[model samples]
Target: MHGTSPPESQRNLSRGLILLLATACGAMVANLYYAQTLIDTIGPEIGLSPGVAGAITTLTQLGYGAGLALFVPLGDLFENKRLALLSTAGAILGCLGIAASNGPVSFLAASLITGICATGAQVVLPLASHLAVKERQGRVIGTIMSGLLFGIMLARPVASFLADAISWRAVFLLSAGLMAAIGIALWFVCPTRKPETKLGYGAILGSVWGQLRRHRALRLRAFYQAMLFAAFNLFWTAAPLELLRNFDFTQQQVAWFALAGAGGALAAPLAGSLADRGLMWWTSFGALLMLTLSFIGADVAVAATSVAAFVIAAILIDTGVQLNQITGQKIIFALSSDARARVNAAYMTVMFVVGASGSLIGSATFEHGGWTLSALTGAAIGGIALVIFLLFDRGASDPD
Candidate 1:
């Protein structure tokens, strides 16, 4: 798996390598989330009113979407290890810049750059797929996804606690260091995967839209995950607000409540295994149902002001979201063997760009109507996805 390695250079992809790749994916994707839970604390310090703080979250997601379209497809045309390192380098700079930001514009710009460069996770995942044997594709993707999901889950709690213990700026500063280490590790350990595609950069970019339009499964899965991810973002963005406002929870308490969602990371490996066993549809159905139920339960918890119930809802919602995401990734990654990165870019761009709106939507809804309204919006999103799954998914093992 070097500069001159063939397509089969790492067909039997080792566990240690998988763990390293998984760690890299998790650490990079975690940048998209550290801002989410800290919106309350970050907004004021950077001179943004509460009304506009969520903009940072949206900007970060938008950055990721921009990267998916603008950079991730390069994984197919360039050496994956070097490309990921380049993206990582950019993310490191973004993190460092955020740690030093003094105004709203500077902070927002840094957030966007961090989000965009965070697509190093995107490159790394496809790189893992390049090495994975056919039978192990789902499992490898799932294992890596577990790390990404855990990173998503862990980031909020970690940020909350870090902000509580030291300062919000420390989170990004620490992350900058982590990204540098991971980038170096990737450069040294990961085998170089030069995509076999002969397509030029412009040609690959052009093929992205066609990839989305051409693949039925890709479209369906993108839509499904988009809805669920919106719910996921809305919950994380709004839940802390409710905690601080209604329950008078301290930042440490909020961290503990947020930590509940970390349990959801377990769903990734399990969902991947189920998809490998041809139960993707059932797994997706269950995931959607769980999400709807979790939202319903969260509404109840918010109304009752019960932290325990809120914790349960957090775990369930996060699990449901991860389950559907892993299933969708397994499906889409199988859609185009030759165009994995482009198809992945298309699938993720649709998901994150649309899903990013959840922050704004949730913030406004919660401000006017409270968590009850927020929960209703999330439930409605989850319910719609469930209906679409029922109508279109049937009992099929895989998409056509």
Candidate 2:
């Protein structure tokens, strides 16, 4: 009775709404990643040097980090349906700008805007968690997150396939159209969720730091996920380059490799079920171990030029990262019922900022020392995260 609550009927998450949220999350989040696999193709066309082309992925992720900081906190200040739709509309405009850009500067700017607006996916996640009952929150979040992970994993291959069939610009145009349709559909389907707080915009935004300070579990879980995500981004960002250069893979073949990586999305619901059973500690430990080992395996495969080894490593890495992310969200979402959005904003803003740096670091490492160095860097980060979890995460437990 103390927190914001809709009517009892409105609290139940209908199957239709669940599916709609999943689809919308997938479509919106896909915009941030489509440029990643196309950097090679787009760079020559736009007259960008290799270094500048590589920065495209980093810039897009940095834009998403900015959006998470600035816009995601608004979920605590406005009706969620309207907030989601507004962000979606911005994503459409950004997509169109990306499609229409004729040069490197314009393209990079549009990429940033596209990344910024893609925070709609972040907003949708917290809204879904808020709508779910306490007992079912992990499952609901996992189901929605499965869709998001799929989008992230599949976007590269889909974009690569499209780029091969049509042109790189066409990928953004198609995404713009898809986002517009999803936005319109979501406008009609999502329930209104009005926050009960009377805090001003400045106060709500200012409260994020306070929330971080107050929640030690939030900080630990966020740091754990951030390190896993950084490694995750490092692998995917450099993988395309490795496949194309070392393996002499065509874009379509690289797409198939990405398709293989999508298998990792399967870990989300399992992680949710594990958290529900109070197995969060073991799950988190296993995920970190898998991530570190996967990178080590990937380094060996890259050195030996073994495609099968690379594919296996990709699956393990993706699965490990997804497991850590779902487990972390389950813990953090239970921290504060009233301020879930702000808590999530704080959590993800830190994660994405670190992840954006991973992209830059991955690119630079690959450019200088090739895939071997990149894989070692990722493995080392994963190892550090595992150590932090063991040494510092004493209070990180599943909520009773």
Candidate 3:
């Protein structure tokens, strides 16, 4: 799979190609999250109840879930790069719809569109894996994955700042422009990689069910990711409210707190390198344990007024979350080189949907039981994730 010492020029070109692909994927994904930073302003602007405001995130998650089931599998039958390009074009239109919206209903409709189209990132990940040399696969994939993590984590703060200075709708306008640019870049830059299988659309959809039955690793990885993402989502979903009520925090301040999680994004490359070094299982196990411990710090942060505790917990939780994500992807990419995109689509679709539900549940729990309830619930979920990891034999199947 690896070319032994390809010409330096070829290696350099591969690196450049990976970077461009990452950048395009990042920009497209940022569209799905733009509404998150603007949810508060959008709710009041559109006269939505607080609970309904939470639906903004929920709706996007549901749309992504639908896309994962409906669109991601097309990577196996359709041209992968073309799918990415078309998805980006669709995302641009979705962002425009959001920017033009005059009410919550319109915004909700647009949000769903954005989520459906934003699965471009899922398609692109497999494209990256396919492009990588075998020996450098994990590190190369990790480098690109880091770029993606940056967009997902930082888009909120960046969008929030933009919305503060401009209108919330302006955030969507900027995203629309970025998506247009990405679609064009992808058309020029992405390598043409077609599917090897001749599975018809009906056969492709049926394959997912067959894959589920045959691939226990896929199921375990998805469930593990689901629980871990739920923990991560629960914190981000509920922490802002806790800060606003107890610490008297402002939205900008809370947005800035996200920077603490950027440290976690930086951990992706490191985790990927570890996976390349043949420590994938250990890295995953250790990261899961660390995430479980972070829940303790998370509980402590609940009532504490000290900035130190909150910051520390944020770093631990975010780092653990990002580590789990990178490690899980490394595992899946190794597990199914033949159908990497569908594998990722399975894991991410379930995990993200879990994340979306965790966010909604976090809010409802906070409303009823306050920060304590939210923190404990998150910690409990993390603990359960660790248990599942422990029960599964990491060596049950050989890495592809």
Best by lDDT: 2
Ranking by lDDT: 2, 1, 3
In model 2, which runs have C-alpha deviations exceeding 4 angstroms?
A: 1-3, 43-55, 103-109, 367-369
Model 1, span 1-400: residue lDDT tens: 4432345656788898898889889899999888876888888888999989868977897798889998998877888888888988999999998999999999999999998998989988987877887677788898999998888778878987887789999999999999889888887878887767788889999999999889878888899999998999899878989998889988788788777768888878888788788788888989999999999999998888788889889999999988888888888887777788898999888998788778777888899999999999999999999998889865433643
lDDT of 3 by residue, 1-400 (tens): 1221233334333666777777776776777677787877889888788888978977887787888888988887778878998888889888998888878888889889898988888888877777666666777777777778778878888888999998888888888898787777778866667767776898787776666577787787778778888887788878888888888989888888886666677777887788777776777778787887877777776666766678788787777776777777777777666677677777777787776678777899889998888888887888887887777756732345
Point out the higher-scoring one by lDDT: 2 or 3: 2
- Given candidate 2, what's the lDDT at residue 220? 89
Worst lDDT run of 10 residues, candidate 3, spans 1-10
- State the number of backbone clashes in model 2: 0
lDDT of each: 0.86, 0.87, 0.77
Ranking by TM-score: 2, 1, 3
For residue 348, what is the lDDT in candidate 2?
Answer: 93
Question: lDDT per residue, candidate 2, 1-400, as tens digits?
Answer: 2245666666789878887888788888898889877888899888789977877877787788888888998988888888899989989988899888888899889888888888999999988888887667777787788889998888988998898899988999999898888888887878788888889989998998888899999988888888988899899879888999989998789899999989999888888888877788999999999999999999999889899999999999999988888888999888887787899999998888777677778889999999999999999999999999999988675565
Model 3 misplaced regions, further than 4 Å: 1-13, 44-54, 103-105, 394-400
Worst 10 residues of 1 by lDDT: 1-10
- Name the TM-score of candidate 1: 0.91
Per-candidate clashes come to 0, 0, 0
Q: Which candidate achieves the best TM-score against the true structure?
A: 2
